[model samples]
Target: MSILKLGALRGQLEIKEFLRQRESVVFTLAFPVILLFIFGSVFKNTIAPGVTFSQYFVAGMVASGLVNTGFQQLAIAIPMSRDLGTLKRLRGTPMSPISYFIGKAIVVTASMLFQVALLLGFGALLFGLHLPTSGILWLRFTWLILLGSACSTVLGIAFSSVPKSGRGASAVVSPIVIVLQFLSGVFFVFSDLPKWMQDIAALFPLKWLTQGMRSVFLPSDFAMKEAAHSWELGKTALILVIWLIIGTLLSIRTFKWSEE
Candidate 1:
């Protein structure tokens, strides 16, 4: 088969396998909604006067979905696949590593998009969130989503390179994801966070992604008022691109097709 057709088939199969896992389905679609209900209810009338709680939560929810699919899933699954000899076996086939990566990327990207849609739909129907009216706002959202996905995918591969075994994969990734969720303003408003915490969070890609997304969904007049207030789209894209490059280099240099 042609490379394009082969990659498409492999991607479809990977997506199907991911969908077959009940826990994955629940976490991807339901977990964010549950969080929305909890947070939206508790903070309903308490968020800053100009900011609607639902509108504020939508950006964070989308960020969470990106993390779940791009970082959490890939970090755990790639190592497991390697440990199970899948990567080694695939390497021996006519399928190139590039094709394998293409398939994997397609599966994860598709899954993330679905998760974003579900979060947006849930936020709209239940919490009365509305879409951004400006086309430029959507353009920013699209840029942030794609950049965040690329950054997360690379970082996931980099982390997968260090895991001693497939069994420890989730153990390592879960804490990092949880910490990021907190620091990235998914659970708390960045402006209310301690200055030190904001400084530390600024070092991570997650913060930039969350802030960039918030700029899109939040009112144009809304400003972070914290160190992260200014959303430098060019700078954000550059940082993600750097992470992507570093991750790519690390993956090439350190990744092992089979358990060592």
Candidate 2:
């Protein structure tokens, strides 16, 4: 077979395998919705003196979904694939490593899209969330989703490079993801937190994504009260781009095809 055919086949196989795994689907899609229900219900009529609970929770959900798909899912799966000799087996095949990665990327992107749609649908139909007011606002939401997914996927690959074994992959990855969820303001309003805490959280992409998402969905008047106090689309785009670049470089430098 030609190299192009080989690559396409590899990607198709990867996607098929992903679909066959029920656990992955549950973890990626259901888990986030569960959290949304818990948090959304808890905060439902209890808005902060100044902020609406639904609005706050929506931002947090977007951030949580981004992390779950981009960082948490990739970190565990990639390393386990390496440890199980999947990556090793691929190295001996006719398909280029780049093609193998492209296949994984396609799978990840598809999964992320499904996760996002499911969350949005659940949030709106059952939870009373409204759609964006205009096409421009919806466009911003799209950009945030793409950028957030890219950053998390690269970071997940980078982290996978260091996991000790397939068995330990979730152990190492989940803690970071869970911790970041709390720190990323997924469960609480960051503005209500102490100043230093907010400062530290700003260093991560989660904060940018959640805040950017809020800017898109919330009223323009609300943006004026944000910490950044403005949409700052350029900053959001820049931060995600930098993280994607850094994560890509690190993964390329550190990733191994085998348990080396």
Candidate 3:
């Protein structure tokens, strides 16, 4: 079979396997909505004069959902596969590692996109969130989500090397994800965060991901509430692209077929 077709088949299998794993599905898909319900209601008051807290919060939650599925899920799954000898067996097969990685990436991208849509729908139907009206904004949003998800997935694959066993995957990866979530303004305003914390967050993709989504979904004037008082699209794109490149290289260099 052609490489393209092979990859698609592998990816389809991966997605199916992901769906069948009830624990993963629950954590990846349901956890974000729970966060939204708990925090969104508490912060139901408005951010700006016109923008309600739910409106402001949805963007960050969407970004968080992307990372949750794209990064957290993959990080754990990859290591668990390694511990289970799945990666070792795959390596012995005719299928190349590239195809397997591509399959994993496809699964992450699909899950994250679905998660983002559900969050947006909930925000819109229940909280009255407004989506971008302009086609250009939608285009930008599409590419940003694609790039952000890709970067996060690649980072997850790379970080999988850090955890030695399936049991330790959550312990190793969850703290980093949770810390980034808090620091990236996922639950709070970026500008209101301390200056040092803001600086640290700028070095990571989650902050930019949240900010980029905010640029798409929130009012343009809400940019004033951002750290630099603007969307900084160029910076956001550049940072994510850089991470993607670095992550791809790292994952390739460090990847192992087995736990030996």
Candidate 4:
């Protein structure tokens, strides 16, 4: 079969397997939503005119949810698959490696999109969050999701090589995600963070992703309040695209079909 068709078939299989993982479904997917309620309620001060901390936190969580779905999910899944010999078996089959990635992409994209919808729904219901007021902002939001998804997926694939065994996958990957979330302003205001923390997070894509996402949900008036004192969306896109290239290269170089 053609690579595209084969990839679609693999994606279907992946969805079925993911559905069967009750813990992954309940916790992996639900953790962010849980955080939304806990953190959103505590930080109720205003960030901008008519924008509350709960609303800001909700917006940042959408970006964080994307990272969880695309990066954290794939990074853990691929390493486990390698240790379990799934990729080893695929190597002997006629399936192109690209097909496997296509399958993973379908999974993360679907999961992240659902996550965005869920977060936005709850954000509106509880925090009075609203969608972008202009078509241009909506356009920006759409691209950020797309570019962010692509960047996160490739980075996840590359990072999968870090954990030596399936048993240690979560142990190794969890801290990285947690730290990035904190430093990248997903859980706090970027400008309010220590200057050193802001500098460190600025070196990574999550910080820019959070900023881009925040700009989408919040008003332009608030851009002046950002660490950069402006959205710097052009910088965000540049950083994400750069990481996408770097991640693709790293995955190609380090990706292994088996533990060997």
lDDT for residue 194 in candidate 2, whole number 0-100: 76
lDDT of each residue in 6-117, candidate 3, tens digit only:
8888999999998998887887887888787777778878878788878878999988887888889888888998998989999998997788888988998888888888
Q: Which stretches of candidate 2 lie over 4 Å from their true place?
A: 1-9, 46-51
TM-score of each: 0.93, 0.92, 0.98, 0.97
Clashing pairs in 3: none
Alpha-carbon local distance difference test for all models: 0.81, 0.78, 0.89, 0.87
| Colliding pairs, model 4 | none
Residue runs of model 1 more than 4 Å from their true location after superposition = 1-5, 224-228
**Cα-lDDT of candidate 2:** 0.78
> Lowest lDDT 10-mer window, candidate 2?
46-55
What range of 10 consecutive residues in model 1 has the weakest lDDT sum?
220-229
lDDT of 1 at 77: 91
lDDT of 1 by residue, 4-37 (tens): 8787888899999988998987887688888888
Between prediction 1 and prediction 4, the one with superior TM-score is 4
- With a 3 Å backbone cut-off (N, CA, C), the pairs that clash in candidate 2 are none
